[model samples]
Target: MQPPLIERNVADVCRTVLDDATEDVLAVGPSPTVVDGLVAMLADRENGPSVRLLATESVLKASVSEFTDASVIADLVADESLSLRTSAERLDGPLLVTDERVVSLVTTDERTAGLATDDAAFVDAAREEYTDRWADAESFRLRTPPLSRVQESLEREFDEELAADFERMRIALAEADGHLDEVDISLLAAARNEALLYDISTWGEGVGIASRATFSRKKTRLEEGGLIETEKVPIDVGRPRLRLLLGDDHLRGIDADEVVSVAAELLAAARQ
Candidate 1:
């Protein structure tokens, strides 16, 4: 019913929301920084209220970091008693925030879904929406420790695979000084895009809408096939630093087009 302790300051907004008496809160947006703050607040034993967040798959992937104990949030949603829920949009941008007293629904136009309803109706609607979402959402919560272990193993495997591909590409290019066709270079770049850097998409649906297993598998396959390289970068931000990935270095100081032409010339001569 009141303005969401509103502020442009993301941390302050989260602190105010978390400290409030409101037992339930819904945030709709694609900002991972805000979501991470909210999750941190909720994860707090003293200040955080039970929180429900809804947004699109792309937003979640972009925002949620892999380091947080996402399983806790997942467990709360799965419990059914806490009445917390999260939703993901197939598209992008804007988010929705609702509590017992207020709902801030963000939209593509940078406006939130503004709806006026009684507290009772809001709760009922949120609950109904959450229930429907839960049914459709692929499980992002993993309680099975073994599964977590398996996921860790898969991640390592992907990392190794990506490294191998990088090495192979480097060797192939070095043998002929990286003279390759523009088309071939473009193809490799496209493939390189699949590498799962330290960003949130690797966390899968728990952070947004894409299926966790699906994102994980796709990223893993890219890594294992040696098409990418993953590493860790340290930062002093909210969460600890994370592992990241980068595209293969095609060649040092060589223009993309020049490399392609040189490679094509070699190939044509060989054919003759």
Candidate 2:
């Protein structure tokens, strides 16, 4: 069955507000679309507005690509600064991120991003409540990306076959520490059948781990799923040497429920 049509009028409002605001505009929220739209809106010199944004650290980091030179608006007490705010109840839709006074509000709704709201009649009243808290709020600077760095990060790493596995590994282990760089998991998979212990030095010597033919074949298998990617890191002398992750057949012995339980435990701990 098809779901009911829910109109997203907030996007239009956001577009209108960005299109109209002349001076500095403040906004806050976790919506990437809002950041993207606002950044694009402000990037224009002729028709664009001056947009300032506030958001949670996670959202800010994830949407780093969308911002211009954003500084942390620490003066939450000041009417002109932007800061993050969340609602008591976790609502289904996006909330308004801006007030007429000075700061912006960030909410869960995707549509309400850069838009002005009819609900902002008490902007002054809300500012009073915010001042009490902003004085105690700690500030951190927003990270800006260099254009050169952005372009460098977008290039492909390994060939298609191994690329997909590396990409999936990165996604699955995104929160895992020490997993930042791209890896060719197929190389590890190739080492799986061999008894040869390949060290980083040996790998540098051009004789280590999986045979080139074997690794190449494994890459082919991974490519069948889809092209995956990760940043390639040269495994220099490491605590643990690189090897291809053993494929699905190795996981056949474990019950699926065990995996689910382990994942649930990790998630629960993460929330805490």
Candidate 3:
């Protein structure tokens, strides 16, 4: 007999399987929505099943492309709320197998659904196959560092005043930042104090946020957009370090929390 197929909105497809699960959950090659969905679900509930998510590089890339969401993933992993891994091998799935049942996903433009079954043979086979695959997978790491780590680094390495400024921007930008990334925000924060690009970029790299090249490229882009200004600072080293500053009269001397909003506004106006 054919297993019952329950259709749902794409976001809800994973919830059904996750909610009904009594023990561990294993997912292989999940979709971006599924990955985000599981992450989001874990955010609201105190706890759910112990989830083991294994993804392909392509899907994992798509999932953590958003920095905010990726930050949460990092926190979840750090706390052991979610066990995430990725495989280099060819495994295509949005397949989910739980202690009580097995679920196979069906995705479409409008909705995603799951065909769930409790059959012993099907569930056991899926569980075994995916368990083996999970064993073969490696821990998935994202470029976005956990929020806690960022805070700790800022507070410990820099003074409280600077760290507070950074936290203010982070909180302000959490909801929306005109599409600015962590690099953009960090550069802006650094420019607020006319801090050196070398210092800021080095800090970012040490924090697992990004690389020096990435910061340099973003600084160039921001400079070209007239969002920030840089002046060469004399250093007793290989090259003169560049100091970051806000280029716009409107952005200069504004509150730390307001920088992202002003920058975003500037970007939107320029787009017009």
Candidate 4:
């Protein structure tokens, strides 16, 4: 068999081969442009060949926003005729193999170049390679609308922020020679809530601190160490309840209002 035909116009060759495909089409790459063309070709056919796309996370994400008709892609995915997946590792470029006869290799980066041929052996090799990669690749699910993507990104950022804050608190407490027990950590976490003041007994029990006497002892120690403070607030005809709040020293120069504003923003973004 002659060597595969090398062509610079990758998109055109992909279109021609895809149009001729009678059985199935397998595509592996991170190129949104080529993927877009494949999607368009599949959409135009009345009862087109089965299609499978193996792409990188970045490529999938970009397609959701960049594609002219993402709804059509979603429809294809819903019907099971079109399958999408993401590779665990990056793919070098785009490879398109159709009906186990024609193969196309397209450049993924700046320069547009490709190779296409009806060479059986070359097509077999490409198909086998795609099969191996597809087996290891994770299924790709596209997020709807731009907001869903934004919300996902914000949620990840919020999780990272919370982890960083926990690590910082751990280090700060360790360096200050203030080894916070479980009770202390619980109290601190509760204090970071919107309602800074919490009922000590209720909070302690919720955190599994069980005994009232033990909780009171821990509370007293925290107060003496300048980590927390308490005030008595009277209830209707009942004994005044002690409310716990973070002490001034424990505020770490963070304003309560500012913290609330930041938290609100994070919550809003996550809800979006």
Candidate 5:
């Protein structure tokens, strides 16, 4: 074992370790900057050293913004050179292990401090510890469209569909003349956002319809008119909760944006 070499700048140590690495590179941290540096190193090689990245969910999300060239990351993954994963638990500090010999510990406090060494015992212990953590981590891969892009696409699609449904609801409300109120609209809007069913009391409170009796009466009317439906959701103890959901017909025919917008307005008013 050798004495660890201290460096004032973590970035310099990282660059040196990565530059000298030949066989493998293992990085664990929540630092977007470090991740970007690794990504750049990988991109520069046609066949870089096999790399494994372990990060927390927050770090991965931050990396999405930091590394705008998502396609490059995807390319590295596709070539089987880079493997990325995320841990639910937060890591203590940043570490970079290269070629089973060199190790770099990156620090962000006071200054960008780092320690590098080729100590066999220290490197082995760090590798073993990281291996265990890696086993429990969830794998992440940067796809062509990427997960964030897919989420944005889904949101846009939902918004467009909801807008169309709101137009229909507007006409229906005008004809009914206060028969269906803001509560009904709020419930419908809530249904559009991926929650198909909700407990009456909880959902009511969440949507700003506080009065139980009023909410119940409105719920009955909506159910009678085929706007929403209810079912019993089984619980481990006590009576089953009454779960409210959009009626099948309403879900199929209505656009969701208008209902959501109206619901938001009603909720805002309630708060004020």
Candidate 6:
């Protein structure tokens, strides 16, 4: 018996398959773009089934580029909205099996097309094989700390005022997506509260977000661009620490929500 062919635009095919699943979907042999697909699923809050992404070690390594930016996947994992696992044996292309009933295996050309099968025997066999494989697969863990940990650590390591400012900046720019990186957000949040460079950078590194050198580099860029300024705070310790402050007076008094847009305008003006 021939499985019926299903075709959809490559861009939309995966999402549609995900939406159609009941309760849970096992996605095997995912490509790097799986990050983007997972992000989209996370953004949409509904009764859609939670996803389990199973891939090889090599494929997971390649996906680091996709997960480098703001990690929504971390949040999803924390809330049990998603799961990550790795397979020892090589797996085939993107195969989505939902609730051991419907199986959709997507293939890409100019458009995405795949064979779909609901035959009782085939689906049952697939369910049993994948279940065994999943049980044998090692769980994959993300290096970056969960967003909840990041939130709590910020408030504990720093003052609530600074933490609140940081949270505000994060929520304000949640939809900004790629416009700003974590370094920029951290710097901006720090500037709002005149936070210590060492404190923020240390927190960032401790949470596995970035290193001190990366923070320093971004700090220099912001300072040279006139978006931020820092004053030295003399202490009993070895070296004086720099306290971050918003360089632009206009930025100083504006609401925390305006930081992203105003900073973008300033950066563009500086570049030109």
Cα RMSDs of all predictions? 14.7, 13.5, 4.4, 14.9, 14.2, 4.9
Candidate 4 clash pair list: none
Worst 10 residues of 5 by lDDT: 145-154
Ranking by TM-score: 3, 6, 5, 4, 1, 2
Give the winner by TM-score: 5 or 6.
6
How are the candidates ranked when ordered by lDDT, highest leading? Answer: 3, 6, 5, 4, 1, 2
What stretches of model 6 exceed 4 Å from their correct place? 1-24, 29-50, 55-70, 78-81, 85-95, 103-118, 129-143, 172-174, 177-179
Model 4 RMSD, rounded to 1 decimal: 14.9
Q: Please report the candidate that would top TM-score against the real structure.
A: 3
Error of 6 at 239 (Å): 1.8
Output the TM-score of candidate 5: 0.46
Candidate 6 or 2, higher lDDT: 6
lDDT of 1 by residue, 207-238 (tens): 33245455445445444543334555556776
**lDDT against true structure, model 5:** 0.58
Question: Candidate 5: where is the Cα deviation over 4 Å?
Answer: 1-12, 105-113, 143-272
TM-score of 6: 0.70
1-272, model 5: which lDDT tens digit per residue?
A: 33454555554556557667786778888477777666766676655477788998777766653222454566677677778899888785578877556454655553454456677787788888888898888988553433233234433534644434433453454344343444465456544443333343344454333456666776666566555667787889997766666665425443553443343344344446
Question: TM-score, each model?
Answer: 0.35, 0.33, 0.73, 0.45, 0.46, 0.70
Candidate 5: pairs in clash? 162-255, 162-256, 162-257, 165-255
lDDT of each: 0.42, 0.36, 0.81, 0.57, 0.58, 0.74
lDDT top scorer = 3
Better of 2 and 3 by TM-score: 3
